[model samples]
Target: MTSEADLAWIASVVGDPARLRILLSLMDGRARTAKELAFLARIAAPTASGHLAKLLDSRLVAVEPQGRHRYFRIASPLVAQMVETMSAVAGDASPGDRRLRRIDPALAAARTCYDHLAGRLGVAIADALQARGHVAFGDGSGEVTASGRAFFAALGLDLAEAGHGRRVFCKPCLDWTERRHHIAGGLGAAFCGHCLSAGWIRRHRDSRAVEVSPEGRVALAELLGVDGQALTSGWPERAAA
Candidate 1:
């Protein structure tokens, strides 16, 4: 149970601009070192260490030690969801940033939200699933249908193997840029991984934006009925169209 003290602690932890920056950098499901986080947060390494310690103590971040290096990532899916939702709320309350608008088209076309696919491609996939009766959406949630199991199984993602985790199984995450819901949760991450491995999409070298392949267009059309080409063409195309 969360007490008021717990809420206050979390509020304080995430309230700092430097700490918030560090957390946002780790939101893409990548474990980063203190040095990298320091650079991203524009703080000294020593200051980053202090922020990291506080985040770690608050259980908002987790550390994994590999050899001589320790990497940090958001502690859990719940934390990721909280950060994402808060971002959406904040975006809603403010005038959109002019700088972000400059790159909005690219980000809207394809981008990553934590470990899952987001942006147009993500929303398209989610829409496809619901259209085909492979999934269902509720207020702010979603569930995989029996057909979803068969569909994903054919694609080589054994839903059963997604397994038990502190992460959610299947759910809709509101996309901040697109103003639509995209998949996020264990299933979302798995879907994104499968797409990457299959060469259907490739990440940009210096951006969170992803590019769709020619082959990916056909595959998405044939498999999920998603029009990847149209998405890349800078237009919003729904599966039904």
Candidate 2:
């Protein structure tokens, strides 16, 4: 059980602008060295190192030594979710707010929320799954139906293997940009992995935005009935719910 003191400690650890920048830089599920993180966070090497020590102490980030370099990454998926959720809360601008209109188009279209998908593309996939009775979301968790198992099996994804870990099997992650839920957890990781491996989606260099390939368009259209072109071209605006 996390006491109020524990919660406040964590909030303070993550509240620093430089530390939050470092955390966001690692949100793409990549481990980065201190030098690289300093560059990304736009802080001096010594300053970034100090911030990193605090993050390490808070257990919000982890370090792995590779060769002579120490790489830092968000400690776990739970940590990533917390950061994303906080972003959503902090980014709740009014509809007519200029900040809302200034969001990057590519990121708002499709991006990685840690290892899984987020943005319009992610939400579309979730909607398709629910509409087809492949998955169901209730409260904060989700479940795959029997047919959903078969559907994933057809795609060569082993749910048992994906779920065989300490991580949550499936859950809804609130997208900061979309202000809607996108699939997260083990199932979300597996699906995103399959897409990347199958050449359906390609991650941008040093960025979370992903581009759908020609093959991805066909695959998503046939499999999930998602219009990749519409997603890419910015059609299908967010309608009234």
* Lowest lDDT 10-residue stretch of candidate 1: 93-102
Residue 222 local lDDT, model 2: 80
| Residue pairs that clash (backbone atoms under 3 angstroms), model 1 | none
Indicate which candidate wins on lDDT.
Answer: 2
CA deviation > 4 Å runs, candidate 1:
1-100, 233-241
Model 2 misplacement above 4 A: 1-96, 232-241
lDDT per residue for candidate 2 within 78-186, as digits (tens), equals 5866876677788863332344456788888788999999987887788778878899987658999999999999999989998997999889876666555679999
> Would you list the C-alpha lDDT of every candidate in the order shown?
0.78, 0.81
lDDT of 1 by residue, 1-241 (tens): 5698899999899999999999888776677899999999999999999999999999888776656777787775457667766777787622222333455677778888998999878877877788889989764467888888889888898676674667688987766554456889889988988989999999988888898888887898789765556554433433254
TM-score of each: 0.56, 0.57
